[model samples]
Target: MASRKPSTDDTTHKLKEDLHHLTQTIEDLVSATADDSRSNIKELRARAEKRLKETRDRLESRGERLYDEARDSVTHQVDACDRYVHDNPWTSVGLGAAAGIVIGMLIGRR
Candidate 1:
C-alpha cells in the first residue's frame, strides 16, 4: 500500500480558521473591556495573554507535527523504492535507463 501525502490546502485552511477564531476572540475581549472596572480590566488582560499564548503553542505544535509527518512520509517512500530496487535490480536499471532516455529526448526537443 502507498502512503498518501498531506494536503497543503487543508493545512492552509486550518491555519486560516485558527487565525479567524483568534481574531474574533481578541475583538470580543476588547469590546468586553468597555464596561469593566480597573481590576476587571487587569483580569481581562491576563486572560487575553493566556489565550494568545495557548493559541501560539497550539499553532507551533501543529506546524512541528506536520513537518515531522512530511519528513517521515518522504523517508518511507525512499525506503520502499530502495527495497524494490534491491529485489529487482535489473528491472530497476532498465526502468532508470528508459526514463533517462525519455528525459533526454524531451530535453533535446526543447
Candidate 2:
C-alpha cells in the first residue's frame, strides 16, 4: 500500500488550525500579569511570530510557483495557437467567421 499525498485544501486547513491555536495561546498569555509570566509570554510571542513568518514564506513561495506555472501554460497555449493560425490562415479565418455567425444569430434571436 502507498501513502496518499495531502491536497492543497488539507494543507490550507492545517495552516488555519495552527494559526487559530497560536492566536488562542497568545490570548491566554495576555491574561497573565506576573513578572515571570511576562518573560514566558515574550518568549512564546517570539516563537509564535517566527512560526507565522515561516508559514507566510511557505505560502508565498507556493503562490509564486503556481503563478509561474499558470503563466507558462498560457504562454505555451498561445504560442501553439499563433503557430496554427499562421500556418493555416484561411482555416482560422473560416472558423472565426462561422463562430461569429453563430454568435450573431443567437444574439439576434434574444
Off by over 4 Å in 2: 1-36
Give each model's whole-structure lDDT: 0.84, 0.80
Q: Write the per-residue lDDT of candidate 1 for residues 18-62, one digit (tens) a residue.
A: 777778777767877887577767776777777778779878988
Report the C-alpha lDDT of model 2 over 1-110, residue by residue, as the tens digit. 99885577987897787678667666756655344677887877776677778767877876786788789999999999999999999999999999999999999998
Q: How does model 2 fare in lDDT?
A: 0.80
| lDDT score, candidate 1, position 108 | 100
Q: How many residue pairs clash in each candidate?
A: 0, 0
Which whole-number lDDT from 0 to 100 does residue 103 have in model 1?
A: 98
Worst 10 residues of 1 by lDDT: 35-44
Task: Please report the TM-score between candidate 2 and the true structure.
Answer: 0.71
